[model samples]
Target: MPQEKPDLRNLAEPVRFKRALTLLLMTLVLPGSAQIAAGSKRAGRWAWRVIFGIVAIIVFLVLLSLVWRSGTINLLVSPKTLRLVQILLILLAIGWAALFVDAYRLGRPLTLERNHRLTASIVDGVLVVLVMSVLIYGSTIVSAQRDFVASVFGNGQKSKADKGRYNVLLLGGDSGADRIGTRPDSITMASVDAETGRTVLIGLPRNMAKIPFPAGTEMAKQFPHGFEWKNCGHDCYLNGVYTWAMGHKQFFPGVKEPGLLATSQAVEGITGMKVNYYVLIDIAGFQHLLDAVGGITVDVGKKVPIGGIGGPIKGYIQPGRNQHLDGYHAMWFARSRAGASDYERMTRQKCVMTAMLNQLSPQKVLTKFQAIASASKEVVQTNIPAGELGTFTDLALDSKKLPVSSFSPVPPLIHTGDPDFALVRTKVAEAISKSEALDKAASDGNGKKSNTPSKAPTKPATSGKPTGSPSKPSTDVDDVASICKA
Candidate 1:
């Protein structure tokens, strides 16, 4: 008898559709499984290997994070690692999309009924689009991070802190295309304890006169007495020092950032603390960054003006508790200087910083990764080296466990116009001592304390005293988070 003819009947239309759907879904849930079921076994095997490799990396990173968080953070922020990860993400996306197409081919939809063929094609197309979209989006985020790292950091070795504390000069300034030079409108020194991450913010008024530079710096030599520019009628304010230094770059010959260096030295001289580094934030672009992270919530102490300094007054941010503000409103809230006293503005700015620190948790950062990464590149410029970021990052995390207290040398504590450097340094030391004592108490009590540390002094002290009384201390220091509770 003739050999039995092989059956050539096509699978039922419904059966073909169901198989196509299964293969498409399988490829999505477990890339390459569909190929193993119906296509080239070799391709399927390769796909599995890729999947396993990715899974292994994820597990390794997770383990590293749990065991050595600081190391993990450093590695993640490393420029070389970031570049490598960006390339790998793109390759993974391309490979995943190809796998979806292969799964469709293995299904052999061409031999199925017309309707089933159309349905399979649609499913295959959708899977490709979805996988590509997600992978490409992730790759973009990685690329942004890499660019940000490269732009902001140098290769300088991490500097050691002085007296177990790192004093960083934080400047908030506005630089417009129409404007001449950047003015550091808001000046604050962040004194962070190297061991405990306890912090104290020392605020200085912008218009404070007789600002002195470091002992050996060029600015100090030129002024000798202080930052007194003769052209400004022998009265140069703190903020104007930047503009003066910029104009008189010859005084700081060969220096790349004369203004910044001079300002850093001025802050050092004023606070009587060694300045580790400086961070200058552009207030004009500040709103964009704030909006990117879904705006910040702050306790509005009073009505803050929106505009009216240069142009017409727009409106006012009404006083309220826990007011959620968008980028435009948040910038105005921090910067509006029309009606509010400079000291009040400084206090409000401190509150803004406190609110941001508490609210911009890890979860929020991850969720708004793209917007934040983009905005960071535009808004922030700092001398903080890439090598030192991990140290500061670890310290910042530690700082969150305790309240952030601030000291403003605006009024009765020390006259800003003619600040007594010795007195300022004494008060700063006293503040640090208080913080250390509080930490000691917490440790002694095994994380249980009957009374939290008081934010301010309960007794007043005479001027020039090393340790002010409780009432006087209140003027200089405050638990910003509690004061600006939302």
Candidate 2:
């Protein structure tokens, strides 16, 4: 009875095997527990400190995000913070894997049966691989985000919100080997309320003539009258403003993007809204962006050509209801103008924009973040500062919940060939005023009966319609969702 005690290292095969598994399981759950229980207490204590420290930091960040969202986002987006996190993840992966190995040694695998030893080895190897793989993958994502933020933003000057709104000029730059340089094919100004996130999209036809430059600006001193090329005739239009400025870069001394600056000035002079920033999207890279989000769905009212502006028509995205389109077809849907008028094309472009805004959910973004980041780097060019990304991102998420109103000066409303600048400015002001009124009403809980149309105007005619033929163009739409709906 006095010799009943059994040695832990000399237990039966089944007992030894069970003990080995228990140690491995403990290491998996808490890296240093096995070490403290059976091995070096010093190493186990250090590992425990690191694990606790990491948990503390994570819990602090989570709490911070709940109370101060933008602050947390800024911390995450900071390049310095990202580098620190990446290094920490790598070290943590290595240290955690080492702890698992140490735990395996503490299990005394060699003392077990052959089958037991093999089983323990396999389980330890799997746990190490799984843990390391997750940490490494997270590090890669953080690295990609850091590179994306660095490359895409911070080139442009920072701007403050003018009054209660932020006006951003969105340009769709079209360039090819056939063309000499990039031209902004699509021009839209997204004016967002700084507080409520209420948004109004103001569109300018690419062919709009007589675009004026803001007073006291360099563009104003050069083009005092309006944007016009004498011999170019009708060829000189809003889109050509970029090409013209690029040719006259000397006028904008020390400016990085003279073309963009000049174009922004022109937009300011036309819309009478101060431009806070500009985002230029290369049309060629747009398809990649659409594909990254697994494509978008849109109601195609008329056929859209694949490639027919300068070349033969490759194909047509046939008209249908709730058509799910891949990157290629969606790009064509947004850019095609083969038989469609510019106004028709603009409507479709807005539809595509609305579809993207409504369809790109946060879940999709998290799952396809790598692909989206890669595509965005290639597709987007902006002057928006890296510091303001958190605010804008938060605003963007807020905007998704509200209706997006749109205004486009088209035929009957205004002549692109002989645009009335005074009338254009008036309409722009009216649209913004209406959006603000609706936002106020909604906030006051009295917006349900508001007269603003809830649906977007019907799609413009694409085929068998002459450029001058008047289509039913609503001067403004209160909700773009109706326009984009199937």
TM-score of each: 0.87, 0.91
lDDT of 1 by residue, 1-486 (tens): 898633324567677678878988999999889888877778889989989998998899889978776678889989898889888888988988888888887677777888778878988898899988898888888888878888878875576899888988989987777677999898988988786687888878897888777778888888788866564454389888788788888888778888898898888888778889899999999998999889877667677888867767799988766578899998998788887677877777776776676677778888898788789888898888987877788777777666777787767777877788788778877777776666666563455332233333332111111110011223456666544532
Every candidate's CA RMSD? 6.2, 5.1
Residue 211 in candidate 2 has what lDDT? 83
Best by TM-score: 2
Task: Name the TM-score of candidate 2.
Answer: 0.91
In model 2, which residue pairs have backbone atoms overlapping below 3 Å? none
Question: How far in Å is the alpha carbon of 465 misplaced in model 2?
Answer: 30
Clashes of each: 9, 0
What lDDT, from 0 to 1, does candidate 2 have? 0.81
